[model samples]
Target: MTTVSPLVAAFRQASYPVGGHGRKNIQVLKEALHEFDDKLESDIYGTGESIEGFQAEMAAYVGKEKAVFFPSGTMAQQIALRIWCDEKGKRKVAYHPLSHLEIHEEDGLKELHQIESLLLGERDRLIRLEEILALNDEIACLLIELPQREIGGVLPPYEELEAISAHCRANGIKLHLDGARLYEVLPYYQKSAAELCALFDSVYISFYKGIGGVAGAILAGDEGFTAKSKVWKRRHGGDLISLYPYYLSASYYFKQREPKMGQYYKEAVELASLYNSCEHVATLPLVPVTNMFHVHISVPKEKLEPILVALYAETGVGLIHYLRESSEGVCSFEVSIGDAFAQIPKELLKRTFERMANMLQ
Candidate 1:
């Protein structure tokens, strides 16, 4: 039922793909388990070393009173909103139009919990502070996705984030951060994880996203808030009998890649700059705020596909996996810098982009 575009098809065939830390193969999981003990006891019903210990570590990492691991961000985030709605005696929550809850989750929030969504701001832009200020809706929570993914991974100014957090607190609105790619933004903001988290009432971060782990997410908040989450976790069947693999990979990569975010950020700027210099090609934001940006090409998908295929074949540098049409004939695809970018040869990169420019012209 799933289809792969020619761009992705070619990118997959390229030997020098310029994205991701590495192949998401058995090797990735193998590296994470390299130091882990085989005789270690696995967690049961969310207890023991792998589960609870990692939860506590993450709680400290994000400067929260408590944290709980979940099988997916979807389950963790829905539970977060449900708890706030119950406490505030409201069933409606607010977030950007492109929020994962609104666009991706297929109405799980509405169907499962009877919670309604009050969408804020337009789809093509980040939610402005003024939009939150004008909100007269009696919503229980306001979710802000840092570096909103759907819109080229753009972030609001840090001052705006502070103001939004203050406004939410003053008005009794629980501000939730959909920080799926939280660590990726820290370098741009020049702030610590705890400092950024202090502004929000609840935070949900993913391990498989920018961290490049197998798969898992953690929801962090005050002890009281987290206690309520555990109850909902059981109700949602989020607790597997054992999830040591996800935990191990998450912990290993979190330690391995957390310090490299600054380097990735710099590489993203460099990559975006090269992308913008190509004829008929540009990047959203004109530069990157984090390790990701959208490469927009002023060409239709049908015509662009062959160019990318040839580009990958000739240069062996697969820049992106797919294309998404914006309006008329313009199309785009996202690029997130990771360990692979640094491994690419500098001379090869120059010829790759230069050839890409010449080809597009």
Candidate 2:
């Protein structure tokens, strides 16, 4: 395990830390496990009601005809791409240069499916309609991550999405959504999950992100697509003895927090404003479009660590302690708003930022 620095340790001990719901632990699993006792013997592999029912419920939520649960988004997405590539007879797909498959997956799609990825757009921006216009049907699918998290959780305008969708549909190109944080972007789009997902041919959503679940994913699409995914899932050995624990937690938290997305977005904008007020600190997007944004500080991580440690000690409210050096003499980190943000007293939060402004100056 990567050891957290003293700054992170101080933030952990702070009276109010402003990021995420809380430590992801067994409590998250317990939060949704009230109904299930140990004697549920009917559940075998994924035949349980929780697992099957969640897949159906999420299918409706995301406006798909059918859905299947996956142990991980990596497994689900690779299968989604493989299905598309097989149907289109092209072993190639396209997505952002910094796509999870491209950077984070250790070439799972390439090694497992023999599928090639045509990386689209610059490293620091959303893939534009023009980029899609330049591609032919040679690529089997195009994956768009809502609120491109790497670029500060930024999203392209809805109109741009419409144009891209139209072009992809007209070109025999399947559109896949990497919607790990799909629920987080709902407030900014001012659209329902179903409406937003309508633009994509297939969608993958994470339960652990903004939903505060234990861990799981849903791959949803038309009947034919999802049926194929189920076959691929079995081929990939995703069928565990029972996934009811993950399913129940995902369903529980989705109900608990889906409605709170707007509130989280409001908190994110407010939080970003406070960061912008501090010298040497800025949030990408200037204003957050969703419940998350990247915090970039114009100070080296080495120098900023002690300052934040001191701040956490002096102020009861912890602002931020984790830091990632974005460039020379600069550092960055991501913040996602949830239950913890509301727990921080408003007056203390304001005072903490005021102290931060002074310290950064």
lDDT of 2 by residue, 126-186 (tens): 8878988887899999999998999999999999999989999999999999999999999
Per-residue lDDT of 229 in model 1: 95
Clashes of 1: 0
Q: Kindly report which residue stretches of model 1 are placed more than 4 angstroms away from their true locations once superposed.
A: 1-6
Residue-level lDDT for 2 in candidate 1: 86
The per-candidate count of clashes, in order, stands at: 0, 0
What lDDT does candidate 2 reach at residue 40?
56
- Measured with C-alpha atoms, the lDDT of residue 52 in candidate 1 is 85
All candidates: TM-score: 0.97, 0.97
Best by lDDT: 1
lDDT of 1 by residue, 1-361 (tens): 7888777788988877787887899888998888788888989988897788899999998999999999999999999999999999999999999999998999999999999999899999998889998764399999999889988899999999999988988898999999999999999999999999999999999999889999999999999999999899999998788888898899999999989999999999998888888889888878899999888899998888898899998888888887788878998888888889988898999899999888788
- Give the RMSD in angstroms, all C-alphas superposed, for model 2: 1.4
